[model samples]
Target chain A: MASNKEDVKLLGMVESPFVSRVDIALKLKGVEYKYEVENLQNKSEFLLKYNPVYKKVPVLVHNGKPISESLVILEYIDETWKQNPILPSDPYKRALARFWSKFIDDKIINAARKALYTHDEKEREKGVEEIEEALHLFENELKGKFFGGDEIGIVDITAVLIAYWLPIIQEAFGAKLFTSDKFPKLYNWSQDFNNHPIVKETLPPRETLMAYYKGHYERHVASNK
Target chain B: MASNKEDVKLLGMVESPFVSRVDIALKLKGVEYKYEVENLQNKSEFLLKYNPVYKKVPVLVHNGKPISESLVILEYIDETWKQNPILPSDPYKRALARFWSKFIDDKIINAARKALYTHDEKEREKGVEEIEEALHLFENELKGKFFGGDEIGIVDITAVLIAYWLPIIQEAFGAKLFTSDKFPKLYNWSQDFNNHPIVKETLPPRETLMAYYKGHYERHVASNK
Candidate 1:
C-alpha cells in the first residue's frame, strides 16, 4: 500500500448520488482528498483500471488501492479513519447497519428509478409500491434521531440519495408518494439528513439535479418515441 | 452476545444453496450448531421473527439475536469465530472479496435463474449471455487455487450455489452453458469448491437437488401454462 495520505482520491461523476454518498462520508470523517469528475459517457482509462468489473464511478483510491461499491467504500472509510465512526462499535450493531445500508442501495435506488422511468402504468405502480414498502420498513426501523443512533451513521449515509434526490424524481414523474402524514418519521428524518452540516454543504443543489434529471427524462422519452 | 456457542442455530431449507453456504461456514469454523430446515411454503414463526425484512431462510440465530442476509451472516460468523477466517485480513482485500461476492449474488444468481426459468426466447438468450459474462469475470478473478487465495473464503462460499446447483438447473432445463473448454478456470474451480471436505459432506446430494429442481420447474411451467 502507498504510504502517502495525500494519494487518496475519488473518481466520480458530478450528479451521481452514489458519488455523493462517498463525498458526504469523507467530509463527515474530516478526511481530505482530491476529487476528479470523470465523464461517465467517455470513462477514463484510470477509472476503468480501478473498477474494471462494473465500469462505474465512485471508486475510492486509498494508498494507491481502489475500493469500488459505495457501501464497501464507506465501510473502508470508517475502518481507516476511525474518527466520527459511521458504523457502530458492537459486531451485531455493525451487521445491522450494514444490512440497512445494503437494503437502501439494493432496494430503494432501483425501485425509485423504475418508479420515475417506466412509462407503463402497471410497472410504475409496482415500483411505487416497492419504494413505499421499503421506506415504511425504514420508518419503522428508525427509533432514535438517526437510523444508527443519535448521530448519523452508515445507514443515513446510504440514504443520501433518498433524502436529496427523491423529491426531484417525484416532481419530474409527477408522483407524490412520500406525503408527510403517511410517512411522518421518514419525512422528518429526510429533513434532518439534508440539514446535517457536512451533508448540506456537500449534497448537490436541488435545482442542478432537477435540470439534469429533466433533460435525462426528456432524452429517454425522445429515444423511446 | 450469546455466551453459549451451542445456542447458535441456523434456520434454513435443505435444498437451499444459501442454507448450504451457512452450513459450510459453520463446519469450516468448527462451530457446532443445530440446523433446522424450514418449510418455505409455510414459514415458521421462528423464521419470520428472525428475518422479518426479506422473510427468507438461512437466518443465523446466535443466542437470541438474529442476523439475516447470508453474506452478512458469513461476516458475522467470521468475526465471531476467528478460528478460520473466511474473509481476508487486510481491509482492502476484504473489500474486493466482498465486491466479487456481491457481484456473484446480485448478478449471477438472478441471471442464472432467468436463463433456466424464463420462457421468453429473447430474454432467456440475454440471461445466458449475462451468466456467461459473469462466470467469465469470476474465472478471471480466480488465482492461487481459490478466489480468496489458497483458502476457501467469502467468495467461494458465495459461489456455493453456483457450483452445486447450476449444473442441476442446467440438466433440468436442457441447457449447456459452462463448457469445459470455454470456461476452464470456472469449471475447475467448481470441482475444487464442491470437493472441499466440509462442503462435500454438508452439500445436499445431487440426486436430491435434481429431484427438487425438477418439481420446482414442473410447478413453474404448469402455472405459466
Candidate 2:
C-alpha cells in the first residue's frame, strides 16, 4: 500500500532533531521513503545539489523537487499526505501551532545550544536563563496533555528536539538544565513525546546519541580552552 | 463594507520590514483593521500581554486572539480570509514559496542589516558578500513575473522588505550596496513590487523612512565610535 506513495527521499542524519521531525512525521503519516544519512564533514553531492543554499540535512526530495528546512518539510508532508494531519484544521489553531513551532525553533533551540556548548561561565549562565524563560513561556502554553490538546501536531514535531536532544546534551555537560522539577509540564510533554509510538520507533539509540554529542561537546570545549 | 469584517488590530511600526509584511498581506487580502503604531522604545502593555515572548511588533490580534511572528501571521491571514490566496495551492510550489520566505528572513535581512549598519569595513564587506550571495540565489528563483507566477504570494510578502526597506537603509547609510546594474532581476522586481497599488498605498513615505533611519544609523555609528 505504501509503495503507491510518491518517490520521497530524505537526506538526513540520525542524531539531528530536525531530521527526526521529518522521520516522525513521515512515520505518522504512513508515508514510505528512502532515507540517506549524510556526513556533515563530507556531505553527499545529492544533498549539496538538493539543498545548495544551506547544504544542511533533512532535505525532503519529493520526486525531483527538494524541500529544505525541517519546518517547511513538515508543512509539505502534512499538505501532501492527508491521512494523519500534523496541523490543526482550523485557521486560528494552526496559526498558534505555527507561532509556537517558530518560537521553539528561533528562541528555545538556539538558547539550549548556547547553554550546552558555550565555554564561558557568564555566557552559559545567560544562555541558561534565556532557555528557562523560553521554556517557562512554553510551559504556560501546555494547557492540555499535548501542545495541541491530545494530538501530536506541528508544535510537537518542532519541540521534538527538546524531548530527545535536551536530555543527551544536559547529561553530556553534567547539567540538570531541563529536569522534571524545573519544567514539569514540558518535562511531562517530552516524556510523552518520546514514548509516542512513531517517535519511539524512529529515535536514535540514546547511548549512541549521548556518546556522539559528548565527544562533540568535549572537543568543542577543549578547542575553546 | 470593509469595516464589517473581523475585529482585527495590528500592533506594528512603520519602519519595521516585518511589520510591512503583515501590512502588505492585509492590504492584499482586502482585510480592514485598526493599525496601532507602537513606539518601540516604549512598548505597550497590550503588545507585551499579547507577544510576551518577542515583545516585538507585527502582532496581529484577530477577534482578541493574538498571533506573533510576521511569517506565521502571513499564513494565518491567508488561511482565514481565503479571498486572495497568498500561498500557492500546489504542495510542492507552496513548499518552495515557504523555503524562499524562510531564506529571505534568515539570510537576506540579517546580512543586509550588517552590510549597512556595521562601522567596520572588513565586517561590512563580509556582510555585503553574504547579502549578494543570498540575493543572487533569490534572483535565480524569480522565474516568473512574480514568485507566485502571476500573483504576488508569500515569498513576495517576505521579500517586500528587500524591495522597499533595503533601498531606504542603503541610501540612509550612504551605501550603494544594491544596484540595478548588479542585480537586474531583483532591481526590476523591486520596481514592480513598489508600483503595485496595494504596496504603493501601504509603503511608508520614502523621505520619512530615510530621515528616521538616517538619524538612527548616525546614532548607532557615533555610539560605536
Best by DockQ: 2
lDDT per residue as tens, model 1, A89-171: 88888889878888887788778878778888799899989889988988899989899788999899988777888777677
Pairs with steric clashes in candidate 2: none
- Report the lDDT tens digits of candidate 2 across residue range A16-92: 98999999999999999999989999999998999999999989998889999999999999998889798999998
Measured with DockQ on alpha carbons, how good is candidate 2? 0.94
Off by over 4 Å in 2: A1-5, B1-5
Candidates' lDDT values, in order?
0.86, 0.90
TM-score (0 to 1) of chain B for each candidate: 0.95, 0.96
Q: For candidate 1, write residues B1-225 as lDDT tens digits.
A: 224545889999889888888999999998889898899889999988999999998999988899998888988898888887899978888888989988988889888888878889899999999999988888899987888788899999999877888888788767887767889888888999999888899998889988988898888789778
Give candidate 2's iRMS in Å, 1 decimal.
Answer: 0.6
Off by over 4 Å in 1: A1-5, B1-6
Model 1: how far residue A46 lies from native, Å: 1.6
Model 2 residue B43 distance off true place after TM-score fit, in angstroms: 1.7
